[model samples]
Target: MSETTRSDVIVIGAGMAGASVADALSRDCTVVLLERESHPGYHTTGRSAALFAPVYGPAPIRALTRASAAFMANPPEGFADSPILTPRGALFIAREDQLADLTGLHNELQSEGNFKELDDSGIRKMHPLIREGYAAAGLYDENCQDIDVAALHQGFLRRARARGCSLFTRADVIALEELANGWRVRTPVGTFEAPCVINAAGAWADELGQKAGAEPIGLVPKRRTAMQIAAPAGAKIGGWPIAVDVAEEFYVKPVAQQLLLSPANENPDVPCDVQPDEMDIAICVDRVERAFDLRVGRIETRWAGLRSFVADKCPVAGFSAAVPGFFWLAGQGGYGIQTAPALAELAAALVLGKPMPPEMVIEGVELSSLAPERLSA
Candidate 1:
């Protein structure tokens, strides 16, 4: 390898999770943030639907999102030129057979956020485009909003840079060696050493663990495809809520002068630069047509991204029990962006051997739920 540069910590990956954690750690540690891509957030982070819905994920994820709500609502001064979140509300619709599911979700999320049950007519009133017989009941969360994903990612990067964190792009880690005092990481561009190594490689998290001789956490990367289509003629969609099926078969939301659609397909795949499958795109079109009165116009754009998950479907954070100084910040699934703030704070606290931040504690975040050791051998 070449001459070694040194830092207090090395973080692999520059997506939302990686950047947020790096920013939090940079306040105290010298951090080297590495990205295999030419730019940060060129993968999943850049392709996110960017919804800040606290009631969107599992219990642990919901807790993290709730903890992050304060930060998203009132970010640090000068973090972004504009607000990170805007009113966009969300409506989870269900057919007659799926009405039970909608009710269950409404009840389950009531403790976490404000969720109200709406009958078919009520749902249609909120979203007039929804076709009759497609939605028997729905769960509405008015607090849910659209997130400025790029701005959020950039804010984390800005904070990290301002705190003296070094960012290196196009630096693919080729080798990782654990030394008694630290880790030596070799990338194609250069070599660097750090006392601690954070595996924040998103879909490639388990691969990085194996490279470092750490125990595998069974991370699975699933592909999700999204596309935009022309809006219906003369339709006023600005006040339209994001409409999602209770079974997760499909979701449609109004964007500026266009409509965004997703089939919510979760096809298992290896880590890669993903592209939307033709069949998946067809499925999305069919579902949207059946669910709404609008016609599917020309596809403006389409793309796919991977959402990584552990077997237990919870985020993995904290130091690895099998590898000294190896920390995990992976398996966030689709909740990474919405829950970034709290997860970053938790990871920072665990890595620095400090207590959980008061803000996180007040939001009832349980560190044990996201600890790396929770994933079994």
Candidate 2:
């Protein structure tokens, strides 16, 4: 026996992307949000090292981040009791051999963020933990900040529900049947039909697309691990900015009175519940200790998450050219949280057949860059 339901749109994941798009579209249409897990954001969204770094991704991603800046900085009233962004600057440090890379990055990001180049002494002054002679130069971006990811995800979910959107957790999508005018999605709980079906299943997006008979976009899910260690004695870590190697060999940041570190590994992986590897943790500790004066105490906790990317390493958004009413909102890579607002708005506008939002246009987001047709072409 099976139950049946219908809506104007069916979102096939309840993570940040799904929640944001559902919230946006629910304003004028019926929305059904489906999650495989018992709770929303049980995957990447929950495990994100959430940061709003405008200069983190490629040009298209930076444009989206710029477009989302206003929303993150000042969310709508009643969205959350506290602000979504908090002051937590970022420092990209480089050794002598990586000076050119650091300079290039700083030059490229000057237009997108407030980045200042610093010499070894300046870098040491900003973050004294770096061992002497390890970092020859650094780039500081004060505009980077910590993001309250839970608040943002909950805000989207709450807004969507308040607007009459239905959310179904533990609704594993087993099949997708394309109808003449809509889609029939069979899940464990019931069958949901909608004219528009959005694929926002994060790392499993390519699998969902194949299930829907859409062409694979060659999305690769990569594993990233992070572990927390006790803060060093007599050192106040709360005020220290996030420190990342210019080549992304490793990164460390303060979290909940502990130091969170990652080797910045991106091992190709299949979509599933990810776990941290002991070798990766050892690599992180080795890299951090070699670069900084801090010794690693016992790893208090550790975890891993997947960050999905396409060949071009840019997000895929917009309607599919082959499959009518099938939308592509995947391949966010590691920039999903920072660029959610703009991408959600863009997805909604495209779905509604409306013009690009003026703000997004001003932010210099070229629709062609994000269109799914680009993959086929």
Candidate 3:
């Protein structure tokens, strides 16, 4: 038998969720970060559209994203070499038939975002590529920005390492058990035991929970496909804001000279290295051509990733009621990157039995909603 390594906490999955929480907890606890893939962020963390929209997601998620703005705007020194967020406004478009949905969305986000509803002329003026008469109305948000995902993710891992957190990539967890006073994780590398375990396994979060004799969190992994295409006829897209359908059927964001398109699909899928489906790509292309004046001559690049979610769509970040010391930190869905900072702080406080961060409390983050017991019970 290989020698057993021990730590105060064992964090499963080294993607953004695991990395961020590990970084936060490393300040006061001995943490062992384990990744199943050859490298961290091989999945969703590296494949996001990488936007920071404070008005996005559920109320809990919006509160978390709002709390994360400070960190995104001004990360700790040496966390990242470049600015973590860059200004890139967002424009939500609505067809005549979809105007009602747009109005409801505006009402819901009026207090959450720096935005305003626009008329037909305004949508065309803001997004020149929009087909004339296709969009009946729009909402322009000036506060949205592009999140530097790589920098943020790498910074979290680097900071955790500097704080003495040990990250072991390719440490595929085969088994997990809650010990009398701790937890034992069996992986290819070795047997690692810790006083507590955090299941940040992304798509496989529920699977990991079952291994630890904990009740299911009802996690479901969904497929979302994205592709890159060249800009239209030498058009300058550097300053263009992301254009999205009001109902979220599709979205197009300018990335340098190229445009990134997605159908905003939520097709249920099993955990694995997900790939873009041909049908999804076809659907995305159809939507893009109808919504915009541009033509997709060729797909510069295409990929797919999984977003895990539970019933409420809010993140789960508490200990299992049936299994002591087993923490649930999964079900981030598509909001993981933007919400990582606040979630990490909240997770650390929960792991260490500390009070919720006052800043998060001020932002109206209620802890009970995120408790694992809500799902397990």
Candidate 4:
């Protein structure tokens, strides 16, 4: 191992979270960013549906989404030529048989706030794609938007580069050891030392922590498959809103001239380059066909990605108490794309002894909830 490699901070994994952390920390310190892949965002970040809805998940995730809006509203200068968010409504459709589910979802929405109620006639007027038999009731959220994920990812990397941070792609960490003064990381290229190591390995976060001699946080990576299908002949789908069945069995949104669809399948999977299975695709087809009256066509392209979830389905971002100088920034589930900016800022604050935003430090989101010690209990 070459001895001349060191930085003030070392971040493993160059996906959205890792890239954001590296970029945020580089402003104050020399940062070394490492990625196992040849390029950043090749995994879950690239494979995301890129929605920026704040009222779609659990309380903690909703809080993160709310905290992230400021960044997404006005991203760093020159982050993208166009605005990050685009207006696209979201509708949660429910069938007559799903009355109970609709009631439960309505209660949850009431708890979350800002969702417009839609009766059967109102839902039919808004979305004609629903079959005649379906659409007992629905809820619409106008705040739901399409996130420019690629631009956001590039924005972070550009900022990192502008801050003189060194990003090392194709350099995977093979081993990590704690030194008296800092941490030593052995990568494919050489050995590096840093006062702290940020574990932003996404789905492989727990495994990476175990390799670094830190306790695992019980992170579970699940596979979610999405496919693009040919647009119906002469059908105007581009202007249609994003729609999902009440059961969440499937969701489809217009993407340019095609359609982006997902079965919302969450099967436990080992961390790797994921591929969609025929069964999953078939399930997606069944769900879509069941809800909509349109004739389904062939799938033009398909892929699967890992959405890593912590035990509580919330992001864990803080330093490890069991192993000092090691930080945890994983388990973002599908919210990583939407909440990257706030979570990264929080991580930077916790790591660099800066002040954290009060809104982001609320119930089950403070330093205590994020500490690695919670995994033991």
For lDDT, the strongest prediction is 3
Ranking by TM-score: 3, 2, 1, 4
Error of 2 at 333 (Å): 0.3
lDDT of 1: 0.91
Candidate 4 TM-score versus the reference: 0.96
Ranking by lDDT: 3, 2, 1, 4
Q: Between which residue pairs do clashes occur in model 4?
A: none
TM-scores of all predicted structures: 0.98, 0.98, 0.99, 0.96
lDDT of model number 2: 0.93
Worst 10 residues of 4 by lDDT: 362-371
Q: 1-377 in candidate 1: lDDT tens per residue? A: 37788999999999999999999999998999999999999999999888988788788888888889889999989999899999999999999988788878877777766778898899999999999767888888899999999999999999999999999999999999999998999998899999999999999999999999998899999999999988888989998999989889999989987899999999999999999999999999999889999778789999999999998789999888888999999999999999999999999988999999888888778887888777783
Q: Across residues 146-183, which tens digit of lDDT does each residue of candidate 3 receive?
A: 99999999999999999999999889999987678898
lDDT of 2 by residue, 172-246 (tens): 999999999989999989999999999999999999998899988889999999999998888888889999999
Question: Model 3, 369: alpha-carbon shift in Å?
Answer: 1.3
Write one digit per residue (lDDT tens) for candidate 4, span 1-377: 26657899999999999999899999899999999889999999999999998877777677778888878988867877779888788888888888788789778777565678788778767777777757888888788899999989989998998998888888888999988987988888878899899999999999999988887888889999999987778878766778888788899898888889999999999889989988999999988888887677777899999999878787888888778899999999989988888788889988998888686865234655556667677
